[model samples]
Target: MKIKVLGCSAGIGDSRRTSCCLLDADILLDVGTGAGELSLEGLIGINHVFLTHAHLDHAGLLPLVADAAGRFRDRPVIVHALAETVAALRECMFNWRLWPDYAALPSLERPFLRYEAVEVGATLSLGGRKITPLPARHAVPAVGYWIDSGQASLALSGDTTLCEEFWDALSRIENLKYLLIETAFLNADAALAAVAGHMTADLLAAGLSRLRRPVEVYVTHLEPGWEDRIMAEIGAACAGFDVRRLRQGMEFEF
Candidate 1:
């Protein structure tokens, strides 16, 4: 399986975009602003979207994606997320006030979008790939995804702070090769990071220290303007691990 980083920044700016990843071509890990980078044809080809949470930086482009691709597709795009996240989208995002309710758009029987509630520990299989929702502690109900392509696996710590259950889940993935974790702030903003349910460099290192196995760590979601400083702090704190900053357009095949 191939994983492509469409966007990995915490916030958008000149060349930076928010979280969004394309797993191969048919599945999206999170449909944030980076989704806008896709061509119209590429957007129309996406059959499934796995959302981490209801936050704008993680799920902002979903409505627009539905609106842009709905007319060209024969079937609705399947959206997989937590029950609370789904509820939040329905109540806040697709309420018709903020955006049209794509789940009911076009027609009820033949709509533009579909919702599937996923719980922590539940795994969904698509073709030969397995996507499992992992534990996450965020400002809202959230989850990370464990993408297993049989030969290897990757764990994404979607917008979360310190959570023992997340490490417990990661420990069980014996073939895990890549860890795309988020460190959204520098040490200077540690207090804000805590309040926002995001990790600072120090917090990330402390969490990584719990892992029993070594994996290629990629730090994602670095807030704009602080990327360099945050990465330097991560390097200093997580000295033993092979960690690097994730960049847009980066691809991994496993």
Candidate 2:
């Protein structure tokens, strides 16, 4: 499977976009501002979207995508997310006040959007790809994803702090080739990172210490202005590992 990084920044600025990824052509990992760059054909081609959380930066643009391309499709766009995330979006986002209820738009019998609840540890197979939700400790109900394509796997940590459970899962992924984890703040902001359910370079280093897998690591979600400082701290702290900063538009094939 081929995965393209649509967006990877924690905060948006200076041409940066929030978290989002395009898996192959029809599957979207998270629909963020990066999705805004897609052409109409690209938006209409998205058949499924797997969201990490209900955070605006990660999922805020989903409705627009559905609205822009839903009517042209033969069926409703399927959205896979945690039950809590679906609830949050239903109550907060698609309530007709913040945005139109695409889930009920036109008609309930045949709407343009549908939501399916997913849980951690459960793997969903699509054609030749397997996607499994992994545990994540975040400000809201969230999860990382492990996308396995039989031969190799790519794991993504969606806006999470340190969690031994996450590392434990990684160790079990025997074919893990790449790990895209988030380190949203600098070492100096360690206190904020803890409370905000984000990671700092120091915290990420600690998390990495628990991971025994030999997979390549790419740090993501660095704050807009402090990218350099955060990456520098990550480089210093994770000296023993092959860790690199994730960039937008980067693609991976596994």
Candidate 3:
């Protein structure tokens, strides 16, 4: 499987886009402004979307995806997410007030999009790929994902703080090669990070200490202007680990 990073910032800016990534062209990890980079044909090629949560920066552009390519396709774009995430999108984004009810538009039986609730630890196999949802500790109900291609695997910890369950799951993936985790704040903001359910450099160091296995780690969700400062802190704090900043347009094949 080849996973491409579209956007991975905590906030948006002229050059920075929020959390989103494309998995082997057909699956979207999160549909943020980064998805706007795709052309019409590129958008049409997407078949499935696995959301980490319902935050706008993570899932804001999903409506446009359905509107842009839904009519050209024979089937609805399948959205797999937690029941809470599905409910949040339904009540907020796709309820016809904010955006068209694509799930119910054109007719119920032939809608442009569909929702499938996913649970933690439940693995879903599609084609030759296997995807499993992992536990996430956040302000809202959220989840991370473990993508296994049989040869190797990649685990993405979608916006989370210090969660032992997430670390426990990562330790069990024998084939895990890459870990894309979020470190949204700096050590100075440790208190805020705790309240927001995001990770600080200190918190990240604590979480990494729990994982006994070594994997290539890329830290994501850094706020735009403060990236350098936060990373400097992260470098000092997590010097013992292999951690790098996740850049956009980067691709990982496993």
Candidate 4:
């Protein structure tokens, strides 16, 4: 599978964009602002979107995607998310007031968007790819994804704080090859990080210590301006494993 980082910043500024990753060509990991980086052709090619949470940074571009690609596609865009997250999107985001309700637009019988509620442990097979929703602790209902291309597996920890359930779920993956986790703040902002349901470099280092197996780890969602500091702190604290910063447009084949 080809995994591409559409955006990996904690917040948007300058060239930085919020979380969004494209798996191969048809599947979107999260439809964040980073999704804007894609061309209209690329957006039209996305058949499925797996959202990690209801946060704007993670799901901001959903409405835009539907609006832009609805007329071009023959079918509705399948959006897979937790039931609570789906509810939040319907109530807060696509409720006509905030944005057009694409799920019911054109016609209820043939809307441009479709929603599928998935449980934490539910595994979905799309073609030959296997996608499993993993547990996450965030401000709102959230989940990460475990994607297996049958050859190798990649684990993504969507926006989260320190949660043992996440680690427990990740430890059981047998063919785990790449782990894309988030460290949104520097250690100096540890208190704020905890309150915002994000991890600091120190927190990430401690979390990494709980892992039973060594895997290629990539740090993501670093807040703008503090990327260098957070990465330096991560390097200093997490000396046991090789952890690199995730960059936009970076691709991984596994």
Give the per-residue lDDT digits (tens) of candidate 2, residues 1-254.
89999899887877999889999999999988888878899999998999999998899899899989987898889999999999999999999899889899878988889999999999999998999999999999999999999999999999899988999999999999999999998888778888899998888888889998888999888889999998999989999999998999899998
User: Ranking by lDDT, best first?
Assistant: 1, 3, 2, 4
lDDT of 1 by residue, 1-254 (tens): 99999999999889998999999888999999999999999999999999999999999999999888999999999999999999999999999999988899899998999999999998999998999999998889989999999999999999999888998889889999999999998898888887899998889888888888889999999989988899999999998889998999999999
TM-score of 3: 0.98
TM-score of 2: 0.98
Name the runs in model 1 displaced over 4 angstroms: none
lDDT, candidate 4, 1-254, per-residue tens: 89999999989889998999999999999988999999999999999999999999999999998888999998999999999999999999999999988999988988999999999989999999999999988877889999999888999999998878888888888888899999998888888877888888888877788877778999999988989999999999999797999999999999
TM-score of each: 0.99, 0.98, 0.98, 0.98
Please report, in order, the local distance difference test score of every candidate based on alpha carbons: 0.93, 0.92, 0.92, 0.91
- Which one wins by TM-score: 2 or 4? 2
C-alpha RMSD of candidate 2? 0.7
Off by over 4 Å in 2: none
Report per-prediction Cα RMSD to one decimal: 0.7, 0.7, 0.7, 0.9
Candidate 1 TM-score to native? 0.99
The residue-by-residue lDDT of candidate 3 on 1-254, one tens digit each, is 89999999988878898888999989999898888888899899999999999998889999998899988998899999999999999999998899988999888998989999999999999898999999999999999999999999999999899999999999999998999999998788888888888998888888889997999999999988999998999899999899999999999999
Winner on lDDT between 1 and 2 is 1
